[model samples]
Target chain A: MTGHIYIIGMGPGYKEMMTDEAYQAMKNADVIVGYTVYIDLVKEHFPDKEFFTTPMRQEVERCKACYDFAKDGKIVAFICSGDAGVYGMAAPMYELLPEYESQNITADDITVIPGVTAAISGAAQLGAPINHDFCVISLSDLLTPWETIERRLIAAIQGDFAIAIYNPSSKKRHDYLEKACQIMLDAGTDKNRACGYVENIGREGTKTVVCTLEELKNAQVNMFTTVFVGNSKSEIIQGKLVTKRGYEI
Target chain B: MTGHIYIIGMGPGYKEMMTDEAYQAMKNADVIVGYTVYIDLVKEHFPDKEFFTTPMRQEVERCKACYDFAKDGKIVAFICSGDAGVYGMAAPMYELLPEYESQNITADDITVIPGVTAAISGAAQLGAPINHDFCVISLSDLLTPWETIERRLIAAIQGDFAIAIYNPSSKKRHDYLEKACQIMLDAGTDKNRACGYVENIGREGTKTVVCTLEELKNAQVNMFTTVFVGNSKSEIIQGKLVTKRGYEI
Candidate 1:
């Protein structure tokens, strides 16, 4: 039996948005490993596969289970949302794979397929918030220091780059997006910048709104929301949003 | 007769990569307009519809033609590769729509749908250069000033953001990517950064390589290539690329 591991990106929570490549990989796997939420998302596709689920923040232990099982020649798949490489499970698993390889316990068969990111999907629902030049930053500082996040926010503001803010805020990190907006306001003209918030992308009850930096500071945002801040070149045109590419007259 | 304009993103040339929503929109269009190259890409899908093709640098004229025909209550689509909102015909058409509306041209309605972007497709093919925080910058100064582009590049480097460089160089402008890389080298550690060149993503003859910034400059690149420059956290792991989110050990 050839032992293999496939990392799949489920995409913004819509069955239609999931790529055919990713679906095929999932169907071929004998064992599926992921967070409980992600497993629930794709449970219908793998009704008969051996399913392994982990609670939140237990990534290391869950990945170890897959690695141990793969050593037994099991066809295993680790699932993620969006692209597996973008804040997904691929990195953590890669880090641990070396240790297992040193022990000669796992084969070198790992493949990662890409999926549509929430940032792009959310931006699509609204007008183009990322048309010309832009940056995406995660406001949650679970791994990175708050100071680092602050510096990136200030740099994005000075660069005049459109920005996508992921993991904007959760129950414990409620003030991060507020601080980000404040940094932008202090760096330049607050009224000139445009901001948008998209919640539950590609899922039912999706909500999106466009506002200014000042308005965004007080906007009701959550972990499910992805916010976009337009650069100086972006504008609201007759209710249709646009970020100009500078070539236009 | 309801005049409507469906601005469609054709994805990255692979029909399987195209979302079902985008395909449905194209199928419903009665008259499709786009640049000659993109028109040729989707010719097979709409053999019966009226196809209008324009030469390069004739965006304004092409958009005018789309608007004029759409005013007759036709289901018109302006085709573009990737997503229509990103570096596509949607922005230019949106900019010119008001001028026509002011002149009593009210018969046409407009809708813009998102398509997969070259940056995402390129990142996917190259193993996720956009896993964490990243930025996208176009090296072309046709519509934007080089000074503005320089400032953004400086900011992206200062923030340690991963970057995607589009339109890096053409026949007339070959020094943009070199100049941009120099700016990054000046701001960040030269040896630690990783860069990738992904050409013709999702299309035949697709080629991708992950290397250092120095190596990328020495490598052959062209207009079809989308370059990804990883920040401090990116690494080339066992020939499979990965970008760390700093969330893991």
Candidate 2:
């Protein structure tokens, strides 16, 4: 019997925030595979299910194991923290799906389940910082070049779209977010542009700070943080970040 | 006794796609309020809960009614399709929240539950076309001017980001999607760029079509259709639209 591979992103790493569809997929799977950190988040809920994990930088191997398990007649649930379609395992998994065709595994044997991404979950935490047209860009220059990142940041600012930044900073790329802000400022964006950041989204110790574009440049953020920069119409109304939708009130 | 307002975006109007938190909020609400079309989608599931609905273009009055209900000590669930933070009621609700201060309602009295937005949901149906940095833009020129929309389209293309288009066309603006494609071409995007569109996402009669940027320009899509134009790294792998994550497999 050829089993199925279910690629699911359980939003913010919380059970409550997970969609019923994702939860059902989790329950239906014979085994779950994910990064070690994400696997730890769901361990308690599915204690008996076999779990296969890999650390950071082992995504290729992790996805391969998922296919191997599913090909061996075991239903597999491959998990990521946010929506897999956005900076998650969905694309990578699809990129590798072709190699397993001889084993009778086809695209039909795979299902990608979407979840609330950090931008949406973080936006809810910040009282809707992305209430208008927005762009989500990652500051991590791992696969994508720094030049491409710079161009996207500049274009987002020029479009006057609210921005959600992922992987804003790391140990080596600690100043990338700062550099991004400087580039936007040089592109004529306002220094006082409304911005906010949420750390540990949908988890314990989740923290949010709303600030101006100037303050965000100097703010210290880690990999767990999701950053938001509001559009020109955005404002901090009554202590909540919101962008008006042009409703005649 | 003061009550609370739960603002939730249940993606694609499907019960399964709703997060556990959103489902719980719906179960706990004393009454539910939304636009008539959206309210009809949930009415069958929560037959016992009171529902208040207004027609389209009455968003202002509809939100005001939610505040009135909440102020009158009834827990209210204000529903929208997809993530509320994305062009939904979250921003408008926060904008109107201040007017009820004398009634003792504050920001703390509201909770916005995020869901998988159409961009993410539609991307899943298309096999992960948005695997890289992406910008979400709406074609409707109701609130935003057409000139601004054109500029954003150009910027998105120039930045080389995959594009997820929302509200692509309406009866009044049927040619907006076509216009957007032309603008991207003028901005130096390839006419053969991989693009896909999904209609009635997560609902019955859901349909998806994969085409090029040129083909997308002539495709017939309505408000329910979410269009995705892949980035430069995107390709069709075994009949699936996928963007590579630069994995060395």
Candidate 3:
């Protein structure tokens, strides 16, 4: 009997931040599969359940192994931080299913449960930086070409859309975030436009800083930080970043 | 003494879809305030609690009343569907606070709680349509200029970013969705590109339909419907919309 594969988002590694549906899905799974970091977040909640994890850059292998576990009659839950559907593990699960069809893995064998994404969660901590229209871009060039990412960044900046940036920097890609800020600056975004960045969102050691576009270009950021650059209407009020809805005030 | 104001997102109106923080915020409130529809979603869950609701287009009036309740020593929970900080109540709450300063209302009087937004919730049901870079644009032109919204739409389409459209149609605006589709098609988006729409998401009578970009222009849509248009890398696999990450596949 082929068991089901559940794709669940753990929502920033906090039990209080996760939806009840996500929590119940984890409890019902006979086994769990995820990246080593995300798996560690839920390990205490399900201490006795079986776990299989892979490090970064091993997403394809992790997805294939999840299908194998489900095919062997184990109800498997695959986890991702933030929403599984957003820059997370859900698409890979569907993208690789054709290769595992011969093992009796079918469309009915999978379910995708949504969770609060970092863009939304981080915006909340910054006090409504995403109050109006916005776009999200990741600066990581591990899989996608930098040229393509640059074009999207330029378009979002030029359009004056509030932009949320994910995977801004890493040890190897130290200057990508700086290049992105330069693009925005060159696009005529006001130097005083509000910007906010949050590190370790919804977890211990979480830190937030609200500044201006010019200041953010020099602010300390890393892969764990989710950065928000507000639009033309954004302002700093009472130490918080607030993007007013585009309307007559 | 002024009490606190909690700007909370109810997360698509289902108990199972809400986070523990949102649920606790509601339970701890002295009274709840929202649009009539969102207030009704949580009414049964908190039958003994007081609720204050206003009709549509009375947002300014609603925000004023919430502050009044909070200033009068009542712990007020201002509710919004989806994330309060995302096109919901959080911004207006801040925008109106300056006017209520004489009433003892201050920035420190409020807190914003994040919840799963419609883009993430609807994408999960459609099978990962926002797996990569994406933008969200609301089709309603009540406050924002139509010119600004159109420019953003064109930019997103030209950038090959997946787009989620909120408030796609209303009784007075029937042809806006068609006009938006024309913009995408004119920008060289393939007519066969995958598109999906959901009505009353995360609530009773939820209905979803997946189709091509050409077909979506004529699809039945309403104010409550959330529409998704895939990027260049999006495809329909096994009758579900799947947007592959920008990697060599």
Candidate 4:
């Protein structure tokens, strides 16, 4: 009586960028559940699959709805824009296991199919800024406290790890990325360290900009943008950001 | 005339796991370059295409050979095991650009195509262990000093980020992973924290093991294994390791 619930990453919104594992999971799903935007991305590929969507900020509700569908013996595919494990639906789905256990649902019924994440996809467009040890932190204060985010930025800078900032800016929070960049500068990081941002990666209207930390502090960004801040060894070689692995020549 | 040199990630060593973007790049290339093991992964698919591989320690010489192919006005595809941006060929290719530029080569001739990295792909098989902020560090001290690696591990532990350890062990570095676990234990981290390792992801002989940190300290690992160590908030729920993302009711 157990049904499958696959958590799939759509991978930056291009069909070509998706892995066959994710594509096959969705293609075989009896029902599809996701945010409104993500559901639209794969609608064309599975025209006959039952689809359900919820708007932004309704993650818990959407995940619950997907669980109910799976509990009823229908194979479900839950979609996320990037890799489902990274700041995506995988955590939320795991958090909901206790609520659905009464319906005989269990974590064993779920599977996560990984895909290309924004940090790697965006880094590819801007050149290679994440060649060594790196850390990823979301700049949004919606779930995590601002103080925690600030401390992580300072620690990452001090540790000299290349950083990939997710949810860098949104409508209500305009100055968070600026404040984060300031923390790096205050940590004695070079103002000219390679910094770049990519918007709408692998989708239409995809735009990318590469600059210094000084310039990125005031650059225009939105929720769609993912930022990359290079480490001390990162440099611009032939007009592209590249961080060497320190291999002895 | 300058020809294209595409830096591609083969994505965990399976045709089904690779993105269409990377596949097409290699399919259209006049010559392909990679390490011997990775080159063998796609050799059957491209029997007609010319391929060149270098043994383990000759990365520089291998990259030089790739540049030579592209500089001679032939399209070349340089393959990396995981995403090219993460501890892959993108940085080395960029570093070699100067040496190739003396042959009238330039950065404009190169393009990076991203794919699923080991951290993400490996996490998928083990459940959602990287559902929050995380850092990735390679334990191998071949290129990077062990002292620097130790410092980053401590910082990542203190920051409470989920950690992905790449190149966890090799022939000469058998005890490196054990040493890293001891640092986490000394930092007062829970000795029973959930940890797991995945080997040969998406290919033959794929194996995964999940256990507590204390067990991981003595676990057998090799260069092909990618390790995941959970943070303070991660736990085992229904036999799956999951890091909850503070969802509000």
Top candidate, metric DockQ: 2
TM-score of 3: 0.97
DockQ result, candidate 1: 0.49
lDDT of 3 by residue, A39-90 (tens): 9999999999899999988888888888888878999899999999999888
Tens-place lDDT per residue, model 1, B1-249, is 367887787778877667666677778887788888888877887688788889988888888888887767788888888877677777677677678776455423676765677887787677667777888898888788899999999999898888888888899987778888788878765855778888888888999898998777666778889999988878886654567766445
Interface RMSD of each: 2.6, 1.0, 1.5, 1.2
Q: Over 4 Å off in model 1, which ranges?
A: A1-3, A45-50, A65-77, A102-108, B45-50, B100-109
Each prediction's fraction of true contacts recovered = 0.48, 0.81, 0.72, 0.74
Structure candidate 3, residue pairs in collision? none
Identify the CAPRI category of the predicted complex in candidate 2.
Answer: high
Clashing pairs in 1: A86-B131, A247-B143, B3-B73
Return the candidate ranking by DockQ, descending.
2, 4, 3, 1
Best by TM-score: 2
TM per candidate comes to 0.91, 0.98, 0.97, 0.97
> Per-residue lDDT for A1-249 in model 2, tens only?
479998998999889999898988988899999999988999999988889999899999999999889878999999989898899899988888889888788889989999999999999999989888889999988888889999999999888889999999999988988999999999998999889999999999999899999999999999999999999889987778887776776
lDDT of 2 by residue, B78-174 (tens): 9999998999999989998779888788989999999889999999988998888999998888988889889889888888888999999999999
Itemize residue pairs with steric clashes in candidate 4: none
Per-residue lDDT tens digits for candidate 3, residues B1-249, read: 569999998898789999999999999999999999898889999999999999998887888888888878999999999999889888877777778777767788888889989999999888889999999999999988898988999999877899999999999999899999998888788999999988888998888888999999998899889999999889888877888885443
User: After superposition, which runs of candidate 4 have C-alpha atoms over 4 Å from their true positions?
Assistant: none
> TM-score of chain A for each candidate?
0.94, 0.98, 0.97, 0.97
Worst 10-residue lDDT window, candidate 1 chain B: B102-111
